[model samples]
Target: MSNFVTLLVEDDALQREVLADVLKDEGFEVLECTTGEAAELIIASTGTELQALITDHNLAGKMSGTELAHFARDRHPHLNIVIMSGTTVKPMPVGTAFLQKPFSPERLLDMVRE
Candidate 1:
């Protein structure tokens, strides 16, 4: 396994499982969660090990993915953050990437690899 830990936050069960499996297959150590709040806890505990964060924009908790992106970026400048959503996110966080819904796994992997 790779040391490049990635945190994936998605409320949808199937989406989270598939994405986590893909990342794992690509040799990334993926930490999966269903809500931004849970993701925040993971990031807080493993920020140093985390290389990337891929989160769905709208979550099932108080914090949204964009909010989580900002928080993670603020604490870990070297972290690569990607916000995925079916709709556009206005004024996306300065140092984060965006993936519109229905994007291919290849595209997502490319973003994370970059």
Candidate 2:
């Protein structure tokens, strides 16, 4: 168990599992969710406990990662936001970060560590 709690929202099952595994291995307690809406519920119920939010830009459900991040930020102002997108370069919001797809696990860890 780790002190940091990370929320991972990725609709792709395989990607989600692999990434979640990586975070787990790094001692991060990760809460996995398939959609932005699902993640929203977790954020609502467990706001202060969440230290970070890592989400896919193009989610399977109605909401995008941008929306989720904004909502989470509103609730948890200090939330560490990481947006992963393969389609195009997403505009980085205030106090948020971006990681283009096909990035290495090392890079991901580096961002979270920062």
lDDT agreement with native, every candidate: 0.92, 0.90
Please report how far candidate 1 places residue 34 from its true position, in Å.
0.7
List model 1 lDDT by residue over 1-114, tens digit each: 479999999999999999999999999999899988898888888747899999999999899999999989888888999999999997899889999999999999999988
Error of 2 at 47 (Å): 3.1
lDDT of 2 by residue, 1-114 (tens): 467999999999999999999999999999999999999999999957788999998898899999998898898998889999986745656788898899999989888877
lDDT of 2: 0.90
Best by TM-score: 1
lDDT of 2 at 46: 92
Model 1 stretches with alpha carbons more than 4 Å out: none
Residue 107 of model 2 has an lDDT of 89
- State residue 33's C-alpha deviation in candidate 1, in Å: 0.8
